[model samples]
Target: MTGGLPLSGVRILDASHVLAGPFATYQLCLMGADAVRVERIGGDDFVRHHGGSAELRTQGMGGSFAAQNAGKACILLDLKAPGGRDVFLKLAAACDVVMENYRPGVMDRLGVGYADVKAMKPDIVYCSLTGYGPQGPFADAPAYDHIVQGVSGLMSMTGTKDSGPQRMGLPITDYIAGLTAALAVAGALHQKRATGEGQHLVVPMLASVLAFMGSYAIDAQTLGRERGLQGNAPFSGSPFAGRFDTVDGHLVVTANTAAQAVRMVRALGLADLEPLAAGTAPDALSEADRARVAEALDRTFRTRTALEWEEALGAAAVPAGKVRGLGEILAHPQTAAMGCLDDLPLPGLEDPVKLPGLGFTSDAWTRRPLSEPEAPGQSTRDVLAGLGLSRREIDDLARAGAVAGPGLPPRSA
Candidate 1:
């Protein structure tokens, strides 16, 4: 590719955990950045658990963790302790970026805020992902993905008219904020290259979620029309395409262009479905006729299962699809054909770890995936050596309760 794993030499100190922050760092790792995830000294990142067996919990990982922390190194550090904070600062001096998802002032309270690190490394790019921006009345209010959806007006706009205030099933807000953070950090990196200075970024999940609802927000402002949910339908104020319940599961048929819509309606034996297509503009379809055509097509789609509709519509060159459950999609042959998942053997994670495999190469596609996530603090000794902490220094820190590594799971296969 033109960029050569563009961030090849970059170093990221990931103080963030959970979905958004860790996923962002995972993307960085794919781009060839050296991202070290710093965890609490008492244990590893708590993202590893959600009430599975104790052995699974002790392995300190789950499917969720696999998706987020796939390509980052885990280093145990107690930011609250004096020695731990010192070690973090030393690592900061060697890094290009620092990421955190703490409530607004938590890092400052720990004496490792942007100011502290900017002094040590002036060109550092520090990004903060939060539920709300810093310096607001709700700055300290705790937030998870679902809460952000409710608070950001996303829940109000989701689902059908009867099912009001439905939260998104996926973590949409978190992923959007992570993508925004990555974009901001990339921009800041470019500026730092020219100006020899760093920038502090504070992006909130609520704001990111709100941005995703731009069309609704715009309509409310300009048309004075309140947004309404229509369930699995686009808000383009047109029903050119809608979700249909097929023999098995569902399929969404979208023909955004009038020509495509014409092709679809003809293919479905509903040639007279819409009004005056030969006279109207290419992108414009009449409301009454469009509704009739959509209803006719909906009935036609129900004649077959989702997969059948998918293949038939694909042959007609129309955009149609069936949404697959995560597990089903993961196990499908296409997952391996596209090379999206790989089972990399790990030291302790019970099953061979499912490493995320995604990256684009101009030459072709990539088959060389990153190694799996290391066992917690697996490189503690080597990292301590790089930090110039002698074995005696490390022993002193260990004795002072400044460090620890992953304890093994009790039950073995």
Candidate 2:
């Protein structure tokens, strides 16, 4: 629905770092916004410790940061210094939106909170993303992705039934929070467009994560039923289910209705399951009968390799997919078919880096090519120049170690 690249002129100050904030800003960048990222001195983000590599240890550009920060310009600023705070407020007053992913009270302590910025620029959109919330009992609790997952009840639905309350393998809580923040900003911008008013947006990562868990929670709430992990299946208690092991890999065979189920059974070449389909209504089939049918479907699905099952499913118009790892998807033909893989140059690495493709398209072109993720604080001096800081003032900030961007690198020389 948002294919239009609607937010083209919008400029976003990506003060938020790590996954949640970066992911949201990335979305905005994809939608044709100028998203500038500001980082601390030395370019240190928490994910710098991802592996035991010398290059990564020094430069702090890990895969996690790269994934979130691609297609955005980056700068550096020392927010601790009084001069830094002054320059940051100046920049905040200049931008349409200011976004941050710090814990509650951090920005306020720095005197750059929404209230403080609102005084300087009345219509500025200020967004703060936190783990718990702006105000709550757990607001003071420090958190990471795993903690948010557990607190939001997402861990309850993550793994097998036996695994009880396990954290998700990926940083889903952080990611979803970013998406929520971006959505909130867009809504606020829309309102701003109409009223010429600015707003403060507080997005709690835990609450956003909880919204994801609510889909499962609603199903877990049937009169006396609590949803259990069937490993991987629909939360709707349907037999049109998931993750069947095949010869080469796994596949999820999901046919939510009897007709789709019939197609799925036929694709698996199970004539026996067809008769069971007749006894069960497409929508009204009891879970037990559906389970029995699903069991039969699983048996037949295993008869072929994942590739064969993919072909079989495609031929039958049934919803099916081979379970693929990240590498598998990148190398697979379907990823190219969907235009979700790209060959991009990365000078920092030995070879040109291959990465996931973009989401938006223009009037004629279906995809926009973007530069590789640069090191954090890469454009510290250049951005300040654009902010209209005089070369002399810029030189002073560089000397004071307060501001970064534009000709500052050469100051040490």
Candidate 3:
């Protein structure tokens, strides 16, 4: 699986948990990095016990955890316990990257912060994912995806003005931070390869979201104007570019350009509205003109089903798509052809678990075959053994409460 992959031979110690941290390491894992998840003894990651699947959640392999945790080894280590810190240092010395998402100074308090790990492995790519940066007024402030979305001003622009601020349906900020961290780590690794030097990377969810809304943020700051909530309307302000209802369902259209707007109206059999849409600029129409054009589009779109309109508008080279549910899109043939999902056999499950794969394909690199998401500490003994600990040593550590996992001796009362 590692052959010809970009991250082959790369080793990462993932001490991070939950969405953002775990997702970053997962991306690297898909690229062929060998990732080892270091979980606390008797304390599982939050996602391991919570997700959409009740059965899987009870088994401590919830859907959220399973989605991003495949292709990694799991090891339990009570870093506070005796001999635990020593074991962590040993693994650090052998790994190329160390990832964590604890609040600022939490790792320092635990004696495994960047400085500590860097002492063990001088040229290690250490990344810290947090809500804010390492040092800031909000550095210690708690944050979740929704909170960051609001704080980053993303919520301000979502939904309709009448509906007020709205959070996105998914944890978009967390995923953005995860992606940013992954890219930063990849870049740091490249620099390390060239200069034999390593560096610390700090990825903040709030900053990631702000960066994602870069143009909007800059416009708001420079022009003192806010797009606010315009519902499904695009920033282009084209009357033809927005969500419209069809006979059976709804679809979104993005006919921002004059030509595309003309094509869209013509495709919908509204040639009379073409003059209103053929303006040189998106906002060229007056409010009255815009209202007239929109009303016409609204009424014309209702003549066909959303899918029918999608096909018709698409054939005319106008950007449009039927609004679809997650399940519907996942089952669509277009999605299947993209190879963006994989089914892996989980150990205790009767059927293979369907999880998302890489977002894109490339001719230069192929992802590794995904492994099943493991139970907490599922590979503890094996990982310790790989660190050169003997079977007796592993059992001693388990019994001493330094580690816990399957295949380890039960800790004495």
Q: Which candidate tops lDDT?
A: 3
List all candidate RMSDs to the true structure: 4.4, 3.6, 1.7
* Worst ten in a row by lDDT for model 2: 357-366
Clashes of each: 0, 7, 0
Pairing residues by index, what is the TM-score of model 1?
0.87
| TM-scores for all predictions | 0.87, 0.87, 0.96
Superposed Cα deviation of residue 397, candidate 3 (Å): 1.2
Q: After superposition, how far is residue 238 of candidate 3 from its true place, in Å?
A: 1.0
Model 3 compared with the native: what TM-score?
0.96
lDDT of 2 by residue, 1-413 (tens): 33546777788888887688888887777666787888887655776445324665466656666665776778778888548888788788878888998889999998889988888889998989888887879988888888887777676666786776677678888878888988998899899989999999989998887676665666567636655444586644456666788978888766666777778767667777776654434456666777787777677766789978887887889877888787877777766767665555443566555666455334543444667766656776677778887888777887777766544643243
282-302 per-residue lDDT for model 3 (tens digits): 558888888888888888888
- Stretches off by above 4 angstroms in model 2 are 1-5, 48-58, 220-225, 278-295, 341-344, 349-352, 357-367, 404-413
- Positional deviation of 107 in candidate 3, in angstroms? 0.5
Candidate 1 — worst ten consecutive residues by lDDT sum?
404-413
Give the clashing residue pairs of candidate 2, or none. Answer: 380-404, 380-405, 380-406, 381-405, 381-406, 382-405, 382-406
**Deviation in Å, model 2, residue 409 alpha carbon:** 7.4
Over the full model, what C-alpha lDDT does candidate 2 score relative to the true structure? 0.74
